[model samples]
Each structure stands twice: as C-alpha cells, then as structure tokens.
Target: MNYEDLFIQYQNLEKSLKDKTKLLAKLEKAISKEMEGGDISRCITDTAVMKSVSAEVTSLLQEIESLVSSFDGKEYIESGDFVSQMLEQCAENGVDVTGSSPNFEMFPNKVRIDVENQDIYLDRKKVACLRPVVLVQAIKKGQEKLLKASFNANKFASELIVAYDLALADLGKNPGTDLYLQKLYNYMVPMSRFRKDYDLQSYAFDLARLYAVGSSVEIKDGRKIQWGTSRDGKKGIRILDGNGREEFLATIRLF
Candidate 1:
C-alpha cells in the first residue's frame, strides 16, 4: 500500500477509535447510574446498547493494533546521505527545502528537520520518531498548515500598536514623532537565545520576514504606522537574512 495512503488510513482509524472510546465512556457512565438502582447481578452484558458499544470499542482497539503492526518501519538515522535523500524526496513531494548539513528546514509551511537530532519540529514542538514514513507525514502536515499560516498584515500592524504603546510608556508617555523601532522590537519580542525558547525566535523570524517582503503595516484608528531608516549613530534592529546581509528598520511613527 502507498505509505501516505496507509498513514491517512491509520489517522482516520485513530479518530474513529477516539469516537468509540467516548461512546464506551457514556455506556459505562449509564451502567453506573443503572447499577445505583440496587441491582447487584447486573454487569456489562446486562444491556444491548452497553454490550454493543463495548464490543465496538474492543474491535476498534484490536484493528488499530493490527494496523500499527503492519507498518514494518524503522528509524531513519541522520547522516550525510540522509540529508541528500531528504533534499530530493521532500522537494519531489512539493515541500520547499532550505538550510544545510545537520540542520535544515522544509515547507509550504515552516518545519525543521533536524538531521543530527533525528527529529522533525514544527513551531519548536518535536516529532520524536525517526521513522521515514513519519517524515513523509510531517511533509504532508506542513502542506496542510500552509493553508492556515498565511501572513495577516492587519493583525501584525495591530500588535505593532501595542508594542509601540508600551515603548512610549517606557519612555515617559510624552508626545513624540516616532518610537524607536528597536525599542518596540525589544518590547514585542523576547531574546530567544537567552530565554531558551524557539517559539520566540520563530516569532521574531516571522517579523523579520515582514521587513524582507516589504509588507505594509497599518493601524485602524486612522493613524499611520511608518518605517524609517536609521542614520549614523542611531540604534536599529538588524534583520539578518541568512545570506550574510542584513536589513534595518530604525523608527516607526504614528500620526
């Protein structure tokens, strides 16, 4: 059977299993209430609905176990060869691949395949299994997530208002032409490296991409949020784009 097809089947079965388990729980609860009527001889076989639901739950569990056993898969250890293989396989399957060596990323959505660590990560949550089919599943999931992860310029601009407001408050709440963009960035994002949080880094990366793509930020309050360049001796947030060059955004003004 096709691995992807089998995986999809397995997922569907798992979902069905959950539904059956819930029905089984309801049956058990109902039985407990019935038993409270003082019938000592009553058991799980006492009613047709109770017996039917319990039997279905048992059959589902067995089928799931059998399906799992049929997947004769093994761990895919990371090596130089594994990286090359993934580069080809992932792209062939329509997931864009980038980065290099032990650490690389793929996406129609953001997923990190850490070859050295034998893991796949989305939003810093690790997929622990090193099974090759699991990687395929991850690629498919990345594609699905792409549909949901589109950049929302309006939401981002709204957050900018919050960050800008906090920066203004920090600087004594006086009327100013602009808030230093670096100050706003510091308020809005955490120092990921020091905090040991990859989610914060991911968030900062998304923000930097906005600058790279020249995305517009607008406030709904009839105010304008504008990006300004930093001149000599002015502090700025350097958006380092992995190719050895950087971009800067120094000031933001709301009027």
Candidate 2:
C-alpha cells in the first residue's frame, strides 16, 4: 500500500528466493548422484526427472534475476532525503520541524540505507541494514566460494600448462624435477581435497606430461605407467621420446 510496506514485501521475497535457490542446488546435486546407476531404463527415467528439476531451477533463477533488475529504477533515499521530506511535510502542516518532536526522532549518524530493500533505518535496530557496497562485496565472496567448490583442473588445463611453463622458465629446471614436483604437490594438496575423485599419483603424472622435458615422452600401448616406487625395489616407468631418448618423469613421494 505504501513505500514501507512495499519495501518489506521486497525484502521477504529476496530472502525466499535465496533460500529456494540453495535448496534447489542441493536437490540437483543429489539427483545427479542418483542418476549414475548402471540400469538403462532407470537411468532414462532419472534423466527425465533431472530435466524437470533443471527447468524449474532455471525458471526460478530467471525470475530472481528479473526481480533484481527491476530494483534499478526504485528510489533509494538517504537519511538526508528522509529528514528533508519530513521537514517539508511538517512545514506544509504548520508544525515546527527544527527541534526534536515527541512523535519524531532522528539518529542521523546511526541511520543507514538498505539498498536491497530500498529503506532507511537506524543501526541500533535489530534489522538487516546492509549498505550497497557491503552487499556487493558479500555477493562477490559467495560467488568466489561457489567457484572454488566447483573447481575442475580439466576446465583450466591450459592455464595450468601456462603456469608450469612459467615456473619452469623462472626456475631454470624441469617441472618434473624432484624438488619442484614436491613443491607442486604441497601446493596442490589443499585444493585437491575439494575434488571427489582426486588421485595424487595420477595428478602428478598428468603434471609431469606438462613439463617441457616430459612433453616429448609417449605412453606405451597396453602398459600402465607407475608414477611412484615402493620401498620393496619396484621401479616406476621411464619416459622415452619418439626418438627413443629417455626423459625424466617425476617420482612421486607418498608421504
């Protein structure tokens, strides 16, 4: 009915949208795990269900995006504007507006504008009072977390190659060298923990191939290459170029 009522309604809708988004994301992840069964008929049925859930999630996301866009034209008045409006209204009604009145109180310093809700309120009140800059920073931080959670090395394989090339060039040693490989493993361990199917030896060999010296090696057909050795005297495969020249491959340390 009024600006205050509309602002409250908008705030409630925003909160509801965020809650629904999180729930839907969890549901999608659960359904995806369930879809990995080996039964063909059941897999087909799961695919259809997944499609329905995905469509619903997409529609909700579009609605939320549209709602956020609509807020651009809405007026966001600061404390000064609020005070000026109150003074003008008081002057029109022949009431004194210079001094603090019994009915009206203002906390100029404590007042903050909530950009999302398009409302102003005192900081002392137990209510959401996020500034626009703070809200943007919060959103960016959440997005960064989401990005990290969904990280996949295959998605940034080129970037990894470039990083290895730079590191090798700067250090004047092959990335497959024992010292650099250990350093790389230490750096990657924390990030690799987030991966569901992470294998340290497999990743180490993959990294070995990216090294300038190891890039010339070719894998033998029907032969599984070992990346690390055991204390029982079992040795790992030696890399060889097309010209039959031996190349160095990193011997991973299990510890």
Candidate 3:
C-alpha cells in the first residue's frame, strides 16, 4: 500500500477506537448508576386519564378477584340471579345503580335489572360481545354487590364518567377510531398490572404491549415529588415526604 493510504487507514482505525471508547464509557456509567441505586424508573406518561383509568381498573379487578375468591363461580348461579336480585333490592331500597357494570361473558346467563338513565351492559354487549345468560346473571350478582357497597358505588360512578366520555369520544370520530382504541386499550391494559401491585410504568408497558401506546417517562428533583401525563399540563403526582422518599399523589411514574 502507498504511504498515504496507510496513514488514512491508521486515521480511520483511530476514529473507530475513539467511538468504541465513548460507547464503553457510557455503558460503564449506566452500570455504575444501576449499582448505586438510581431513583425508581417510571415507564409511562403522567396523564390524569391514565392514572385515573389505572386506579379504576385496579379497583374493579380487585373487587372481581375478591368475589371470585369468595364464590368460586359456583355458588352465585346456584343461588339464582343473586346479583340482579340484589340490584333490584337496591332499587327497592332506593339506592342509585347508575353506571355500575358487570363483565357479561363471565356469567352464563343475562339478567336485566332496570336502572335509571343507563342500562347495565355486560362484557358481551360492551366488548367481547359473548352474551352468556348464566354468566350475565353472575355479573348481575357481582354488580349488585358493588352497587350496595358505598365505597364501590363512589368508585364505580367516577369510572363511569370517564368510561362514558371516552367511549363517546371513540364513537364520534370515524377516522380517529385508532386513536380511540389506543385510548381505551391504554386504560384497560394497565389495570391488571396495577391490580397486581406493579407501579405506573410497568402498567404503562402492559398498555403498550396490548394496545401499542408508546410513551417516555422523565423525573426531576423538586420540593415535592410530581407526576405529569400526556393529556394534562404539568400536574403533580407525588410529594417528597419528610423522610425524603417520594410519595405518590394521584399518579406516579418513576424516574
């Protein structure tokens, strides 16, 4: 090779070495930070809807789980439309059953209880559309339990407002159907993780995996731990406790 060619080759080699060195340094720094215990990593955006949705789903799932644990699915049907009956009882007792819903397919039969303003639609009518009458009956029993519980009623009402609005938004836009699906799936996906005690980011990933809603998370130091979401502007989700550990507010996404 010519002397000039040799020098050019040497220069290229040098550049490659420098690039490799830089990447190595970055990897080392990341490893060091990881070893030293960096702040909790958040995997999602800090949106009010996201947080609210997560909370709602987790709470509902928890209720369903509790019911499942108690009944094992066999007792309710044997008892005959227990949930629907209970809902009727609530109506007779004059309790508000507005917006309380049951996953319809989970039941083998469907029992319709007349509620003011909104008819209780099960999972079959709502999403999966598998209207099993028995399962529907079980769902009625479950929903009746929910309606009777003051705590469940409050949470269900709040979720109903959000769900209805989101569903309406979905129904309105034809071209934006994908966006609506993303939003709905985003809310539904994180629910299982939240129910299982995973933090917001983990739940967010679940949404991404199921619904393909992608997002980035960032954290900064402040007087209080704060969370922000894509939909809302600069809303805080955390506060620094006296002990300095960040406490979550309405939402939490790790650093």
Work out the TM-score per prediction: 0.43, 0.27, 0.17
Q: Which regions of candidate 1 fall more than 4 Å away from where they truly are?
A: 1-78, 107-122, 131-137, 149-152, 168-186, 189-198, 201-218, 225-255
What is the RMSD of candidate 3? 30.9
Clashing pairs in 2: none
Q: Which candidate order results from sorting by TM-score in descending order?
A: 1, 2, 3
Estimate the lDDT of model 1. Answer: 0.61
The prediction achieving the highest TM-score against the true structure is: 1
Ranking by lDDT: 1, 2, 3
Model 2 lowest lDDT segment of ten:
101-110
Alpha-carbon shift of residue 149 in model 1 (angstroms): 5.9
Q: For residues 100-170, could you state the per-residue lDDT of candidate 3 as single tens digits? A: 34321121123342233223443224322122333334555764563354333233323423443465465
lDDT of each: 0.61, 0.42, 0.37
Evaluated at residue 72, the lDDT of candidate 3 is: 28
Model 3 score (lDDT): 0.37
